[model samples]
Target: MPITNADVVAVFSEIADLLEIEGANPFRVRAYRNAARMLGELGRSVRTMVDRPEELDALPGIGPDLAGKIVEVVTTGSCALLQRLRKELPPVITELLKIPGLGPKRVRTLHRELGIETLAQLRQAAEQGRVQSVHGFGAKSERQILEATGRLLQQERRYKWADMEPVAQALLADLHATPGVHRAVAAGSLRRGRETVGDLDLLVTAENPGTVMDRLTASEDIQRVLEQGVTRSSVVLKSGLQVDLRAVAPASFGAAWLYFTGSKAHNIALRKLAQDKDLKLNEYGLYRGKQRIAGDTETAVYKALGLPFIEPELREDRGEIEAARSGALPRLLQLTDLRGDLHAHTKDSDGHDPIEAMAEAARAHRLHYLAITDHSKRLALVHGLDADGLSRQIDRIDEINASLRDFVLLKGVEVDILEDGSLDLPDAILGRLDLVVGAVHSGFDLSRDKQTDRLLRAMDHRCFSILAHPTGRLINERPPCDIDLPRVVRKARERGCFLELNAHPARLDLSDAACRIAKSEGVLVSINSDAHSRLQFDSLRFGVSQARRGWLETGDVLNTRTLGQLRSLLAATMARGVGQ
Candidate 1:
């Protein structure tokens, strides 16, 4: 099996986790963590870069040592350092890190203070009331730990869509190459642009179904074949992801695609609509008294039921049917509609690339402009800029912009929003920037009202142009802070500011539901890549997908505006703070 970027990411991440638990050098641990992140968010294939040592070495945060290990893992499907660490540790020590509140520091504390290394051991300690006695843990902490352990145990494994993409693409390529196959594509939640997917549903049209099944089962990636049949087959990959493949006749390919690409609720609604029309719908075709009427195309299928073609991302039964029937479905936002990315970083903060490299990359991606929103000094670990540093950066951006032709580089900062509803940077410093991207880096445990108010106060700042990653959630790694997002969206409208639909796969904050709320309240959202590296510009496509899922149109996205229009809107926001 070919080693995927996700495979390499997992190996590197494990190495970092184990190193952290072993109390190795903090910088050493951070190196592995950073490399894992860069590769995970990279748009291209790391596996294909094995032969180019210089290219691999050039990746941000990947020095000679780390680059060698990446090449090792990609070519060998294993890393000796990771293997050795696994053997030296308690084997299950890494499992403890999955619990909600347990970071490496907390895991180290648990392992050293109570000899708890496995989930079972940790759970027993929490249950027996021993964990609360630890230095930082209390009764409430112990209770929460127990609850988190139980939740982890019961949760079904779901892979992020970004992680599953390469695997899915590889499988599609294999199926397409199979002699008898004519068409192959993935369906189900993966097609719906869902953030996380539980399993894959693949549809294929082939001359010989048996040959396609043979090709699938013979793959090196398969862990085991669950079942094999003439028309259908199921297998589990070594990565623990289950895949189901169905071979449909060419005539019914589109019907099968629609049936399998379902949100079960969406399918049920469609079926009811078909029934009301006295038509029959199924995997085979839409029929009238045993005569096939529509099946060869999804558009044909929807048309037969007197509705227009619905985008797959909006097939969530979230009023889509009613909207379609009333000719009110949104012309959803597309990747092409995005004109620029407003939130990004450079080496000035914790980002990997230099300012010039980042700007060139944005231009390469065809963006008319890019914003350099590095961290503020409050985030000391990233060596965030102070007032003087930001002032210098503003000057540097102006010089760079002067030298460039059509592309402009905007000066900006991802300033921290302090717990008391104040910004980390002074008003004087903030006033100099083209825009301000406010973020909450700590204190996620605040009450809903407090969190909402915190955001409201930050938006009230004169220079606040956008709220970056509004909820401060990191997908599976962290829960969204308790905040009333609707109120925050309303506040943005009143303040003439915008909310960011942060496009990082790990933090797709201002989630679909939040985007819908923003649209309803007439608050335009900026779909930003939040790119730490140039390669991360690809993340904007995923952000666009999320926006479509939220029923966002071109007009609902702030970044779709040209640079000139964006400047006018931003100026209005800057002036609104003075009067309001």
Candidate 2:
């Protein structure tokens, strides 16, 4: 099996987790964590650069030691340091880290103070009321730990779409280069742009099935070939994502894609339509019994069925059929339609890049405008802005704008929505910006009514323009706080404030369902990268994928507007217009 970037990253992450539990050097533990993050965000597989390890050393956080470890894990399935740590600590020590209330420090405390290591042990500690005896844990903490353990036990393994993206692209590029290959495309939940995916399916048309199958089995990332046949093969990647490759004749390519690129509900609907017309639709082709017809392309199949072609993203059978028949299907939002980003941070806060560099990067991405909404003072850990700091940043933004052509930086702040529903920064400072993004950085444990009311109160604030990562989810890491999302969306519409679909892979908040609800409520959604650095701006495409899955159109996204339009929109959120 070929070592995948994800595999190497997992090794580093596990080392970091185990070392933290062992109370190893903090900087040493940090190095492993940073390397894992760097590898995850890398645009190409680390395996491709294995021959020349210097290229790996040249990456952002990768030093000689980390580079060797990368080559070590990629060359061999595991690393020696991780092996040593496993011997030194309980093998299940890392499992404690998955609980919601447990970080490295707390996990260490649990292991050292209570001799707790596995999920079972931790659960016993929490349940028996012994966990609260630890220095930092309390009765409430014990309850939270117990709940978190239960949730983790019931969860299934899933991969974020962003995590799977680079790997899939690399494999597709390799397949396209295979000798005598006519075409190859990845389909299934991935093609439909699901936020998380279980596996990948590749459909190919080629002259030599044997050549494609051989290449797939020989790939370094293949952990094992579960099954291999003349035209179909399935393998599990080193990252545990299953991939199935199917080679078909060019004539049935479209039919094969339709059959495979399905939402089961959507496919059933299509088949029912075909049956009504005395036709049969399957992987081979749509037929009037024994004679294949309308199978050369997706457009041909849709045309024969008397329905407009639906984009793969909308193949979820969510009223798309009726819309297609009525010619009411959306011209879904595309990445190119985004004019700028409204929620981003810089070095002034916890971000890695400075203002000018971030603006230049945005210009490089062809964005016409960008907003620098660094965190406000309540997030003291990030050295978030006080009034004076925000003022300085605003003046700096003006200075940067003077140096650019066709690109501008709008001063903004991701002001924290406090527990009692107040803005973290004073209105005097917030009122001066092009926009203000309100977010919930803490208080994720509030009751549904309290949480919904908290947000509703924040929306009543005159400077509130957009809600950032509304659900506050971290994918597989944390669950969303209890809140009436529907009420929040309706209130945002009435107040004219937009909701954000944060593009960051960890928190693709205001999820597809929320996006759809926002659209139905006639509220606007802003697909922002929430980028902390210039490289993170590249994550905008992930946000676009999520918006497409939500059936959002260009007109439904607030940031797709020109700078003038966006400014006019934000102006409505100011004090003077609260009653307008």
Candidate 3:
């Protein structure tokens, strides 16, 4: 059977990680890493390139050796050298290589002297005082291992976007304040609005690159300066985030920023467009026959390619170039377009504010309405409301609405999407609410099929007005559940259920790609803050950015409507679906 592009990318990634553990040349390791990234981002399968070795070799960072390996893997399901290396190496050693500080040499020492092969064995050895007695291992190393083991056991395998947002924002702010820095902004994963960032990148424009590097290397926030030079500096922050800052002249600032802000796949597509026109694009500027043009702004760059300016979020090289060239880029939603927030908590649950205070805050924000979506009865730890509590809350909403002339407060509940695909609240309770946001708060490790079924069943509930933070991710902390998003999106559209672009900096759920896929499948999105406090309303800006990246229009979002309009839509949505 032909393997997927995902499988090919996964194999290459594992190989790259193994090579790094072996202390391979940094550039060689990077080449494989880049190849893996490119393969993962590719729309076509690696199998398609097997017949055309030249085509594969022509791709960025894929040299003869790498290209040959691609062919070998596609043809034989494995490479001789990779297979040999894996066979010769104990699986425990290979597994141990994944630990952040442990490298091949140290791994060899542990395996040979301490008989430590697996993380479990290593932990045992460290606990038994075997590892600390080794030549280089010490108390500190043992402590680090213990901490890493604790962290690994406590969380899922992948990080979420929410966990990385503050780190990226703080670092960018610090870099901007550094003396001699003319301009600075985050690029790469953070700029692309990824839910989880592998590393952070900052593009800086400065008069004296050397001075900028000096200041960056000496910054207090920097845990260690990984690499420094005139044009670029890479530092690891105290939070274990690797941030790369590159400096360029003012004249090339825009170009450099765009280049560095890239989803690399986007840049490659842009370069291809330049190639077709006999032009060259680089960090300096766009060039036609050695003549520089369009370097001052991203708009100019896109105009030079005869395309409309693509939004940063949309520049994922996923049909964006084609959409821009065809003058068909969707009129994406913006923060100012939102009329209300659909998912908010109050003192009725774990939220700090009372229902009246939450409503007043919404009025202060000039929002048309706010939904008081406190936790449901199932989440007892969070003071989740039972049916009686929800009924009382509705009466309070009526009183608040009666008291407030400027804004409306909607009765809403963040009901739990239970195991086996049932909702925490029944139709009798759900039917009384102005809005219902179905969400997964626990049992997140369900099989993909089961998770999807659970969400679909939730959407099938007539009162499920929206699906909040569909993936239930907290950036850099939790990986998303294994549910198939496309299927959920399709079901949502069919059922007139809105998918939420959760606005919490940590959640940013319905990631850019997932948002795009949802929009394409015709599911309406509710750009919700899922706010617990008034301060969190600002997180809606991040959601808007994500919506724009996904090509969501104001009309595509439920919250873009006025209070009356939104209420009408909610009623319409409820009337169509089967009751719980």
Quote each prediction's TM-score.
0.97, 0.92, 0.72
Model 2 pairs in collision? 1-220, 2-220, 2-221
Best by TM-score: 1
Candidate 2, superposed: residue stretches over 4 Å from native = 1-8, 42-80, 90-92, 113-117, 120-142, 575-580
Better of 1 and 2 by lDDT: 1
Ranked candidates, highest lDDT first? 1, 2, 3
- Residues 1-580, candidate 2: write the lDDT tens digits: 4567777888999999988878889999988987787676555678889899889877766789888989898888799998998999876788888788788889888888999988988888888999999999999889988888887777777788887766677788889889999998989988988888888989899999889999988887778899899899999986678999999998899988998999889999999999999999998789998898888788889888999899999999999999999999999999999999998888899776789888988888899999999999999978899999999999999988898898989989999999888899888888889888999999898999999999889888888889999989998888898999999999998888889999888788878888999999999999998877766777889899999889999999999999999888888766433520
TM-score of 2: 0.92
Mark the regions of model 1 whose C-alpha exceeds 4 Å error after superposition. 578-580
Ten-residue region with minimum lDDT total, candidate 3: 156-165
Instruction: For model 2, give the 10-residue run with minimal summed lDDT.
Output: 571-580
Worst 10 residues of 1 by lDDT: 571-580
For residue 491, model 1's alpha carbon misses the true position, in angstroms, by 1.0
Supply the global lDDT for candidate 1.
0.91
Residue 257 lDDT in model 3? 74
lDDT of 2: 0.87
Check candidate 1 and list the clashing pairs.
none
Report the Cα lDDT for residue 79, model 1.
96
